[model samples]
Target: MSGLNAPISCDLLVRADAVVTQDAERRVLDDAAVAVRDGVVVEVGGRSGMEARYDPGQRLDLSGKMLLPGLVNAHTHLPMTLLRGFADDLPLMEWLEKHIWPVEFQLTEELLAVGARLGCAELIRTGCTAFLNGYLREYVTGQVVADCGLRAVLGEGFFSFPSPMFPSAEDCWKTVRDLDARFADNPRLRTAITPHAAFTVSPDHLAASFELAVELGVPWQIHLAESPSETAMCLEKYGKRPVELLHDSDLLGGRTTLHHCVDVTPDEIAILAETGTNVVHNPASNFKLCSGVAPVQAMLDAGVTVGLGTDGASSNNQLNMFRDMGLAALAGKVRADDASAMNAQAVLDMATLGSAKCLGWPELGRIEAGFPADIIALDLGSPNLMPVFNHVSHAVYAATGMEVCMTMVAGQVLYLYGNFRTMDIQSLKTEAGEAAKWVLAAAGK
Candidate 1:
């Protein structure tokens, strides 16, 4: 449709010094260029080859930066950023029952919006272009994510018991249906059916939620076996382990992702592998909350897909995937009693493609033709990243969250260096600070 010398037009061209494709081959290309059209990657090759074929309307030159797929936070409670550091230094139950739940119960839509905006800022700045979020009133978070241009799976968390948002379980199911219908056409927004946890949500409700998720063709996730106490409670209440209960309820499958399997046994790991159910390992949150380490090595060895997450800012205090990756690798080694238990590449994979798998988004977490243009650029000249022996090693072991200079989702640049292009960071920070103060006074913290 064009003359011989006229190059094909594309929406944008992103050229970088080196690109960690994270593709099937995990190729690291030098002087790489990615051509994007309509938020999809049209082509990826050497800079000259791409330039010669495509004429880009806009160009971003990461001359001294390394590009890679943006990290995916497999599990999180986004609005909990307002609860960060508010209820620390206590046991999990006390922290939740006395402090966290009290504040969550008192959260208004305004406060939730403020916290979601602040959390979205942090996620963008830290190179997370996609995340799975579970919370109450997730439509508010969904609206914020839609405005911010981030890819997210938002779910309204429900339990068998009455809560502030939903008086009955039927109310929660209606909310889920409404969310699915509302976001059905939005490419970047998705709805999920989420029960709060195995211990809190009864078996009948859990099975019903799973059926609803299946009916809607969406994801089903829950907090399962997060602590020994939770496993004990599930056993005492249902005479079955958490995983066993879920299996009995027909809740384990490829579309399901369980967060924080810290207390899972070997048999449970096998069950996960056999069912093809995914698991999200929240290393920092587990350690911070004194929950035991997840047997990630065992899970990975058993062929169970494992992903990485920061849980919630309230527990992990930050949604930085780099920090979580470093901890995952280090803690994996410590847990396995081997220096090379979970390698750099493996942990990086967990944060990228592995997490993408957990979110049921197979096309993301990779840089390739036909993939969405969810990518990030890091300043390669950072002091800690210097003397780069290997790109994956540096990314996993040495790189912190601060090295991210640009974060793009669906070909839209949401963050550039220290600037947020989608939202007003200063205004959101002011509102978030005020909301935190209100939480302090209202929750009696």
Candidate 2:
């Protein structure tokens, strides 16, 4: 973490009239102000008490709004925003084969960086402070995220054949390590092992990814049991289900986070819990791709740590946490047929704390004295926020990304009142458009 600011003074204090601290007590302090020091929250209480106790360097007024911890998108593909509306109305395999894969093959360094910057713009505007992004390559995506002031756990998509970045298996191995070393001392970015999936990554490649993850002390993200076709193929080729194969291969462990456990059995859920592995539920992606509903409630009931994610805008159509929470909550209750299947408060926690845990970040999620001052203010004056009976309930059911008035990460404000503070979106958009033209032509579109 050499490039990280050396944990300096917080140098900022923010006062929001309505502070929604999603702590164990679920305290919502009125006329509250938060004190932040060295990028961490030092105190949260009444404005008078805080002003009297500490002299503030910078004070921000967030009256008529609700302050909560910045959201955590447990999984995403940041650069995939360029392909969002580029491909639609197809199943997972069909979409990938017909549209996504072709464009991915034509993705140049410029295209990758522009797409990532555009995605970063979208995330900052929508109040997402951090995300776990699995990338096809590393150099450009890492640089874009670091330059744009966002945090992502990135990795090379361990593919079996050729890739836009890595042309061969040897190239893949070299790229992962090189990217890991490049970002090893980085503050805002860390590299993880992102094997495409069991369907694409052979056993040898997956084992190598696990070894690399352990070597770098990073976590792993991979698609597991996403479709019945995947499990059936694994059974045909490897004589076992996808989860069973991973378990027998010694890759099913705490350091692994699997995506879309749709075809997994109850026993597989037990294995995830027993091994401390996590699962990411992308309800919108599943529904759009017709991948079937994941037994997420079953996984949670089995003590597995579950987090919410918008797989990618291409699959999800949007990257908004409010909508993600809505879909996540509805997905559970619809499958379980229980009104109390996933509480609104629990879904909010999933977007905040639970997703943080899945990414191995401890200080995020909580609005406590020692947590990072990554916070957001949602303006509750919109028609949706009107007559709010419960703040948390309104946040889950009524709110949308448009209500976010500010987004702060590491005690630094990146977006405020619909305006991004750190980057130039117009220039980024123009550059991305130029690269996308090349992409579309190269992709034979």
Candidate 3:
């Protein structure tokens, strides 16, 4: 306390039993406090040091809670919340071509908005403060995320064939441009160009989408090697693998985030590393769809930046990052036949800091001075999290998303003590149910 400054004023002071700063050093401080001002963390130190330095307008005493940076969901399809459990237990191609695509052809803007609302609510309750969303009608999704006080990169899906959202590929481009312009200046919402997949999109369309992404200076996302059938199709049609096709089209680079590289080869993994392209692993979704496990440990060994994702509620059946972390660790070990693979601390890093790097947000995913105050509190009093001997082990192996009692983004509490300050969760649930019913009926499902 000798080095502490004279008492200063700030917006909020959050004190907890332990502050798990997921920084480069991975330091976990005991009896810690963080002072936030203007949505930025001004200080993080011992409780006595912070209390001596700043006089806060509001103080939250989380005596029985553990503080950590909010989880970053690197990839998801938010509007698919309406389709959760609508179709399951099928191969990837059959699931998409027969059921998912047909229902998506019946989605209206209002229905899409309802689904986005539901997804936002679920993500907030589960300690996710930011996400990368790839789906249709992204403007609606962007608005919903903005209103819900969450940070997101919203992407509009593009395909060569006509769909319910757009009549032509040009129509999809127009929507992307419109969404980009609308959210260009927004602090909480950003835009991205998303082509459904390499196999589904024509070469010309993919080239145009990448050019547009470059022009807009935003990241581009695409599904790559999600299933064996997809890899087979790419090989049969293009005389190359999916990654080779993207590289040939000049689409593989630092600004690209490829989701589900479950079938990628060693050479492709090296290419991904050399080109600085990011990979997102959706373990639960892949396992559920029988798509085979992604070589996450191999990717990490190849120096590829890998992050964790839930894919979508439809495939994952939950928007919980805690479950994703656990599954990622377990799957990595099983896939590698080594208990040392994807240790608990590494999985936790993938959920927070690693995902932030994938999103190109340097100031997020850490609790430290000058970083954005994106934080969450987990109830340590929970029975499962009791007798915590190791912070990282407890967080990754034992604690579930239900233990997250409060979620804050940019120093603002969005959900606290089971109450949402920004959105109406009950109304969203009712509306989402209605929307799901309408879409199912429209598609005659």
- Candidate maximizing lDDT: 1
lDDT tens digits by residue: candidate 2, 1-445 = 3234333234777887678898879888888888888778988899877766666678888877889888888888888888878878897888998888887877777778888888888888777888888877677888887777777778677578877666655567677788878977877677778888887888988897788789888888898898898888899999999999999999987788888888889988999999998888888888889898887778878988888888888998888877888888888888878889877887888888878877767567777898888898999777889876788887888888889999888788899887888789889878877876776787776
Candidate 1: give the clashing pairs.
none
lDDT of 1: 0.91
Q: Which stretches of candidate 2 lie over 4 Å from their true place?
A: 1-10
Measured against the true structure, the TM-scores of the candidates, in listed sequence, are: 0.98, 0.94, 0.97
Clashes of each: 0, 3, 0
Model 1: lowest-lDDT 10 consecutive positions: 436-445
The best candidate in terms of TM-score: 1
Q: What would the TM-score be for candidate 3 when compared with the true structure?
A: 0.97
lDDT of all predictions, in order shown? 0.91, 0.82, 0.89
Tens-digit per-residue lDDT, 63-86, candidate 1: 889998999999999999998988
Clashes of 3: 0
Sorted by lDDT, highest first, which candidate order results?
1, 3, 2
Query: In model 3, what are the clashing residue pairs, if there are any?
Result: none
